[model samples]
Target: MALMTIPLIIFLFPLAYSPGPGNMFFAANGARFGFKSTLKANIGYHIATFIVTYLLGIGFGVGVSYSPTLMLIIRYVGVLYVVYIAWGLIRAGITKRNQSAKHASFIDGVVLLVLNPKAYIIIALMFSQFQPSTIDPQFYFIIGWISAVFTLNNMIAFFFWTVLGDKIVGLFRDKTKAHILNFILGSMLLVVAAWMAYN
Candidate 1:
C-alpha cells in the first residue's frame, strides 16, 4: 500500500491535467460563463467523479472493465455526446454569441461525467494498477486513500483548466480571436472524442 503512491501520482497527474473531454468541457464552460458562475457545474462534476472513483476502487467496477460489449456501447454514446458538445462550442464561437444564457447547468455536468467513457476507463485503470483485493487486510483502507487522492488530484486539474479558460476569455477580447479560440477548444474536444472512439 505504501509503495503505490508514486505510481498512482505518475499515472493520474498527466491524464487529469491533459486536455481530455472532462477538462475541456469545464474549461469551455468557464470561458463562456465566468469561473465563479461555473462553480455549480464544477461541484457537480467532481462529486460524480469522486463517487465513481470510490465505487471503482471498492471493487464495484468489475462489470465495466470486463464487458467488451458494454464498453463498445459506452464508447459510441460518449463519442456522440462529445461531438454534440463540440458542435455547441463551435456554434457559439462562429456566431459570436455569448452563450451564458444557454450554458450547461449542474445537472448537465453530472450527466456528462457519468456518461463519459474516459472517466470509467481512468477509474478502472487506476483500480487495476493498484490491485485492490478483498483478500488483502488493508483493502478498504487503501481504496479509501486512493479514491481520496485521486479525487483531490482531479479537483486541482479541473480548477486549473477552469481558471485558464477564464483568463483566456479576457485575453481574447477581439471577436475574431475569441472565435478562433472557441474553434480551437471545440477542435480539442473533437480530438478527445476521436481518441475515445479508437482507444
Candidate 2:
C-alpha cells in the first residue's frame, strides 16, 4: 500500500496540473471573471472531478472503457464540442478580441466534466496502476482516500492559476489580452476534446 503512494503521487500530480477541460475552463473563466466569482465554478469543477474519480475507482469506469456504444457517444459529443469551442476561439480571436465575454459559465463547466472522457480515463488509468491484491484487500479503501488527496491537489493547482489570472488581468485591466488568452484556452480545450474523441 505504501509502495503505491509514490507512483500515484508522481503520475497523478502532473496529470492534474496539466491543462484539461477543467483547467482550461478555469483559465478561461478566471481570465473573464475574477477569482472571487470563479470559486463557485471551482467548487463545481472539483466536485465533478471527484464524482468521476469515485465512479471510476469503484469499477464503473470499465463501462466507458469497454462499451462501444458508450464510447461512440462520448466520441461524437466530444468532437462536436471541440469543433464548437474551436470555432468560438477563432471568432473571438478575429472579431471580438477586445470583449470580455462570459464564454464558460458554471453550467458549461459542469457539462464539460460529463462530456470529458479524460476525467474517466484518468481515473481508470490511475486505479489500474495501484495493486489491490492485499490479503484483506483494503487497498481499495486506500485508493479512495488517495483519490480525495488528488482532488485536493487539483483544487490548489486550479486556485493558483485563478489567483495568477486575477493578478494578471487586474494589473493590466486590458480586455484584449484576456480575450486572446481565453481564445487560446478555448483552443486547448478543443484539442483536449479532440484527443479524447480520438482515443
Candidate 3:
C-alpha cells in the first residue's frame, strides 16, 4: 500500500491540479468572497467527492448501468449550472460594487458535484486503474484508502487554486483591476462549461 502512494499521486496530479470546473469554481468564489468565506463550499465538495467515489468504488456501476440516460442528463444540467454561475460573476464584474454577490453555499457545492459528469468519469477511471480484479478481504480497505486519497488530493488542489485567486486579487489594490480579474475568471468558467457540454 505504501508503494502505491507515489504512483497514485502522480496519476492524479494533472487531473486534480488542472484548471477544471471544480478548481475554477473555487477560484472564482475565492476571488469574489475570500478563502474563509469559501470554506463551507470547499468542505461540501470534498465530502461529496469522497462519498460518491467510495460508492462507485464499491459497485455503484451497476446502478449507473441501469440508468442509461442518467449521465447524459447530468452532463447537460452541469453545463447549465456552470453557465449560470459564470453569468453571475460576469454581472458582478460589470458593477462597481457587487452588493448582491454572495459566496457559494454548501448546497451549491453538493449540487455541483451531483451534476458534474466529469467528476464521475474521473472516479470511474481511478477505480479502473487502481482497483483489484478479484474481490478479497482487503478490497473494501483498498477502496476506502483510494477514496480518501482522491478526496485529499482534490482538497489540496482546490485550496491552492482558491488561495491563488485570493492572492492574485490581493496583489491589485485597484477595484478596476479586481473587476478585470473577475471577468477573466468568469470567462474561463464559460469556456469550461462549453467544454463540458461538447465533450
Candidate 4:
C-alpha cells in the first residue's frame, strides 16, 4: 500500500488538475464570490465525491453502471444542470453589480456530483485500475484509502482553481474587464456542457 502512494498520486494529479466541469464550477464561483464564500460548496462536493467513489470502489456502483437507461438519464440531467449554471453566470456578467450574483450552495455541489456522468466514469476507471482483484481483510481499508486520496487530490485541485479565479478577478479593477471574464468563464462552461452531452 505504501508503494502505491506515488503511483496513485501520479495517476490522479492530471485528472484532478485538468479543467473539467468541477474545476470550472469552482473557478466561476470563486471569481464571483471569493474563496471563503465557496467553502461550503467545496466541502459539499468532496463529501459527495468521497462517498460515491468509495461506494463504486466497493462494487456498489456496479449495478448503476450496468444500467444504460439510468446512465442516460443522469447524463441529460447533468447537462441541463450545467446549462442552468452557465446561464446564471452569463446573466451575472451582464449586470454591473456582480454582488447580486448568488454564491453556489452546498446542495448545488452535491447535485453537481450526483448528476455528473463524467465523475462516475472516472471513478469506475480508477477502481478498475487500482482495486485489488482478490478480496481480503484490508480490501475495504484499501478502498477507503484510495477514495480519501482521490477526494483530497480533488480538493487541492479545486482550491487551486478557486484561488486562480479570485486572483484573476483581483487583477482587474475595472468592472468591464470583470464582466468580460465572467462571460468567458460562462461560455467555457456552456462548451463543457455540450461536450458532456455529446460524449
All candidates' TM-scores? 0.88, 0.76, 0.91, 0.94
lDDT of 4 at 105: 86
How much does each candidate deviate from the true structure in C-alpha RMSD? 2.4, 3.9, 2.3, 1.8
Each candidate's number of clashing pairs is 0, 0, 0, 0
Q: Write the per-residue lDDT of candidate 1 for residues 1-199, one digit (tens) a residue.
A: 5578878989999989988888998888778676877787777887888878887777687777679998898888989999999987876643223554676678877888877888888888788778565647787778878888888888899889989888878777677887887788888899989998999
Worst 10 residues of 2 by lDDT: 93-102
Q: Local error of candidate 2 at 59, Å?
A: 1.6
Better of 2 and 4 by lDDT: 4
Give the true-structure RMSD of model 1. 2.4
Backbone clash total, candidate 2: 0
- Residue 53 error, candidate 4, Å: 0.6
Off by over 4 Å in 1: 1-3, 93-100
Q: Each candidate's lDDT (Cα)? A: 0.81, 0.68, 0.83, 0.86
How would you order the candidates by TM-score, starting with the best? 4, 3, 1, 2
lDDT against true structure, model 4:
0.86
Clashes of 1: 0
Write one digit per residue (lDDT tens) for candidate 2, span 115-140. Answer: 77667667777777763645256756
Best model number under lDDT: 4
Highest TM-score scorer: 4
Give lDDT tens digits, candidate 4, residues 1-199. Answer: 8788789889988888987889999998888778887898889999999999999888888976768898889989999999998888876643332556677789888998898888887888788789988899999999999999999999999999999987777765576776788788899899989988998
Span of ten consecutive residues with least summed lDDT in model 1? 92-101
lDDT of 3 by residue, 1-199 (tens): 8787778889999999998789999998877777887888888998999998888989976466236488778888999999998888876753222446677889888888888778887887888799867899999998999999999999999999999877776764476776677788889999999999888
User: What is the Cα-based lDDT of residue 160 in candidate 4?
Assistant: 100
